[model samples]
Target: MGMRLWKDMQQIVGAGFTHDTGLPTWFEVAKATFLQETYQKWLLYKDDCVKMIETELVPQGGLFCNRTFDRYACWPDTPADSMVNISCPFYLPWFDKVSQGVVRRSCGPTGIWDEDDNGQVWRDKSQCEDELEVTAQELWLKQLMVSFRMLYTIGYSLSLSTLTMALIILLSFRKLHCTRNYIHANFFLSFILRAVSVIVKDTMLERHWGREIVKHSDVSDMLSHQAAIGCRIAQVMMQYCVLANHHWCFGEALYLYYVLIASVFIDNNKLLPYICVGWGMPVLFVVPWVVMKLLKENKECWAFNENMNYWWIIRCPILFASLINFMIFLRVIKVILSKLRASSNQRGYPDYKLRLAKATLTLIPLFGIHELIFIFATDEQTTGLLRYIKVFFTLFLNSFQGFIVAVLYCYANKEVRSELKRKSHNWRTEAVLMCCGQ
Candidate 1:
């Protein structure tokens, strides 16, 4: 009699499982077994059947067992079989009510349990998958942290050195504040901003200090959003400033060649505006693009894709600027060689020939090859490794620019060296007096 009642319940549930169409063999058997057990439990405790299934059986035993069975027994190709075993048990009326209530309260009306006419829930599966993938990739961020630390160290050190060298030169040799030094001062200013950006972005991403600050702050969300916006602006400005420095360097080299080789001279005061244009144009071009991107793209962080067209917009100008600088370097070389040949013929000895050759060789490692690395390495779709390499090289190369320029143009001249030494001694004496007074 009991077996007959269980079979009757199975027939009812089995009919529901198979609509007008057919059902899979495995799904039919699983549905029959589930209905038979549910009917037996219902008979034993009629009022407590729903409570037992909802609280203890379905939540603990039914869901857990169904999940395990589906994982191992379900055919990979049969979506119907998989769905029946994994999903149908959750629709047992009581479980459905509890699940719906909990989901509605936590996720609102458009919650996970909200089903369409086809009885399929409209959940954002892609969002869940993306979160899972990001969590998995968190381990790789350690490497990025290391790279960021290295870049910050190199950039900060180089920027400070460049600024110190420039300040010393400006104060000690006031007479040497010509067109070149003026342009260099602007470059140093930009480098300072770049250094600050690097340190801020690196610290935020790697150190978790922002997270700690947010824990303690009252208006954490507003502060974080502002910081994010500021960081993005800083990054874009830094890159534009770098390009501006390259442009100014190219212009300086052109001016030098025009004066020395082409016998063309322009007044220093008249050339100041052109110098300003070299630095100013890049900022103008980059600011609009950044503003538009900020309006459209994600605002939670500063990253490469903030301006998707950054490479396309900036590449042409940078390449053109690099080419112009290379042309100036070639002209300088040609002029030096011509002078050396003339000197050697007149004196029957190598006068400026060895010195010029040595200077050119030294510059190959300093300016020529260093800039070439940047030109060659800057691809539109740079990967993390490539980005790291580019930043590392930029920091390493530019860090030495001020030192090399000081050595070649300043120390090489006896007058500038004498003035630098005298200024260094005076600075040291003043520093000692201040410390002693304190």
Candidate 2:
């Protein structure tokens, strides 16, 4: 099959030179794309021919029929007249000046022959490389990667700072350590860690840094692998933090729903169980996924390129959490509307529905409605204006979610403002006393 294919290729190349043949057909054009593979197969045939010559015929000295027992000796010694219709057994390197595909030269009275103006007998592989288009595509892809790195770097930095501030506010103020604030603090902490992990992952995976590591390493085999320790750690930590954030949101909704439906305050001591579930359940889910991924395909960073099952490991939990939270939200809304309906004009009721709408807007991050946008807008179709819209939308929402949480739960709250004012007044009083003493 390989020999016949080579002979047919020669005929095709010969036919290509004839003006009567006109342009190459579609199949011939398609065949031109396989030039590299054709060359490799021709090499294989040469190897086989050499092996047959080496094994079958014993060389009298270092020569065979006055020729060295090398590639030339492997050539079939057919008569010059008989070679007209028969294909040459030897492989000759030839460059297609037109289609840039590989062709071969037939053995004449002399040995294998290929001569051009350069006097180089080797194949002109320059034509095989689509340098213009391939390089452009590679550079284009690199630009996209750089842009993503910059976006995530800036976004995560902003998120990390805001989330840290939110955490400090929630933790420092005893008055703010309510059940809702506690859950929000958990989410804030998780998001902060997640942002840090993203930064670290980006740093470790930076092309220059990775290349530098390999360059500086003395042990050739040690630092040569794709899955570096730092990158793998970052991947695991990022996954854990993401899962923890989802679980914390689920915990928040569950707590609120329980309070509304059961009409009882969950004792401060009882929070230990919820805390265990919120933080520890993520470990349960993430560990199995990490172990399975390492066992199955221990490739670079356990990234998204793996089998679909690994993806479902993380996504399924988040989706389930979101679905449950949505159901809880519906129940909570039902309860609020029931109470509003019960209270008539005699009670001088405000627009509770408007309040509910505002509250739902604040809960967008918690309830996972934002995921629907990603689900419907397929990434493949997300190009041009839609791509930019998605980028900006995600940049604002993900990067500034911590800021939104702080504003809604801390700065906007009456109790937090009062506590801040009281602390400021005390600080001023103490400063005046200290200055007088000095």
Candidate 3:
């Protein structure tokens, strides 16, 4: 099939050559010829099928009476007609079947057709008898969809929740809203923007609006490309925000470690500069990339060219950032361990709780490790289970970070724990008061 397609492509190109442009002209001519030929063939096929049904199979009583025959005849006609008009026959058969009311029943109360009798003909209960028993390929696709949904939902929820929490803490608990929380608040704002962008992109893709917008546009192709480039710039900014936030977390950890272990040697005030650098560096890295993207023709936002050496643009900083985070984490661990050892003579060790905290800290590196797997596995060449695994792990791990931080830090911190307890007590007290009044 591949070789035949290649030969057909070559023949198409060979037939369209002009004297002036030579090979390049021939290539362009060939591409146009191939598209035209393909379209014509699709139209011919549809016409043949439609002619067959209308002439041979259509009942004299009309198509609507006998549901079975009517469905059979109408199925091919609808798709065939649509394909003929659109000049895209690839989806004709599928759409025809779907449009003809050949629904696959489900096992639900509506018997898979639903209350409105609107059943999806693509994959019915028979094909996917037991969803759990689905083929690995099917499961992988389903899992990918699930992962996408999970990331979209979790990212959006966390962005909103975190931002709200940060704002409340900053405004209400002013004394508790220190530098780290201030940085976190700004990061959450950026995260909210990122989440909104993701939701918009996903919604557009789901509705096919993105493609429709392009198809229906009257703008020149070059102008369309320029607009795409601008969107890409915005996308890079979102990525920068995420990376910078991770770096900021590392800086926070480092500052905390220094204050605990090296307070006598280092000025605590100096840590503020490190925090500023962590946040500012990502902007510096992204500005040039955004400018270059604006100047370049936009083809795709995420697809990378094998011939282009753009991998380093993301990989280098990610590697450096991850390394720095690891180093900071290690420093914290070393200091904590040293303090625990030195204070052995003071009182009870709090061994169990301390062990648990250390274990949690150790798990932080897993985030970066899984992210690396995601980075390497998501390339043009990746396929099958590996690709799905990478996607699932990446989405799950990245999202898990926010939850982990919330659980470990918020639960462990005396102040946050107290605040949450107080809030819960207040809610209960309000409920009791309302009941008594009633």
Candidate 4:
């Protein structure tokens, strides 16, 4: 049967290819996507089956499904009304492509080869179809991943460029040197680290996952064998940067609250405590998470947080900072409203309320309060449209935060704009004097 199938494949390849006169043209032919390199194994397997059947040759014992060779597997004489499974053929195209799983062949009563609706003998490699279906799903997800990564990659690149420009501008003029700009510089630095770390982590995972999944190696084993330590370090740094960025936003809110609402002055541009909270506090959570991961759930390049406890360890500080910043936002708004009311004694109540609503909307991004809606994230298991919306929004916001902050605080600031204008005028005057002298 195998030999005849092989000839049929040759015949299908060309019109005058076959030497045999009669072929089981009625038999359903397997698609010839098998690897040519594996043809030897196929022949050896087929020969062994033929020899075994010949040695144990027996007349049909009542009703029995005849021993047959189809696709690559040699089906043994199955008893009537019974089904059997054969290990999937590795030589087939999808064998090594998808992860291995259960395979089954169907048979009906009366002990004959399975028949299709057309009354033709059928090869029901149901699991092969399943593997193909899985392959299709995976292909779809891969395309989606590529698209999302592109979106975030562009965002991070844009953010990084803007942040560098903002930092340079902040540092260029000594007149702008205050506690506020100092915090801004540190905030920009955190975002720089964040963008770099995220890019690095993504690159590492692509290499690791691409190699491991395709080759059918266990993820843990692949990580252990490859650049596991470096990848883990990248993961740690990414967490630290993310923590610092969010905490710095909290610092921004706190400083505003203190100076404006509490009427307290920070003497001599002192920001040691704020600096510690922004850069140092992440260490506390990161260290513990790393220790716990090493002791408990060390595997797979440390890319995914399989342990919810570990995830919360990193997340709790970020959430705490966000929530506190939001409270400070409300407090600052209330104070500003009261002061506005006292100063604008002639204004109507409705007018002040309208202004308050605008102020709230404006402060949402300034305090990073808008992130409250996206604070909770969906996991890999999350499906359907909700998951997609969350993923896109969360990724877009996270990646472009540096650019957004730079635009709002540095590029769009009246003070910064005035400084740049003054500098430009001074440079123009110097150039004119030089030309006059010449």
Local accuracy by lDDT, each model: 0.49, 0.57, 0.47, 0.68
> What's the TM-score of each model vs. the native?
0.56, 0.64, 0.56, 0.67
Instruction: List residue ranges in candidate 3 displaced over 4 A.
Output: 1-140, 184-194, 200-209, 213-223, 226-230, 261-266, 270-275, 295-297, 300-308, 348-359, 362-382, 419-438
| CA displacement after TM-score superposition, residue 101 of candidate 2 (Å) | 5.9
The predictions' CA RMSDs to the true structure, in order, are 17.8, 11.6, 15.3, 13.1
Candidate 2: residue 367 Cα off by (Å): 3.1
lDDT of 4 by residue, 110-207 (tens): 77777668765555455643222346766675566567767888888999999999999999998788988998888888889888987776555444
Q: Which one is best on TM-score?
A: 4
**Which scores greater on TM-score, model 3 or model 4?**
4
Tell me how far the alpha carbon of residue 290 in candidate 2 is from the true structure, in angstroms, after superposition. Answer: 1.7
Clashing pairs in 4: none
Residue 38, model 1, lDDT: 46
Query: lDDT rank, highest first?
Result: 4, 2, 1, 3
Across 237-273, the per-residue lDDT of candidate 2 in tens digits comes to 8788878877877887877787779646555436776
| Candidate number with greatest lDDT | 4
Model 1 residue runs over 4 Å out of place are: 1-148, 151-155, 204-227, 268-271, 295-298, 306-310, 351-353, 361-369, 379-392, 411-413, 421-438
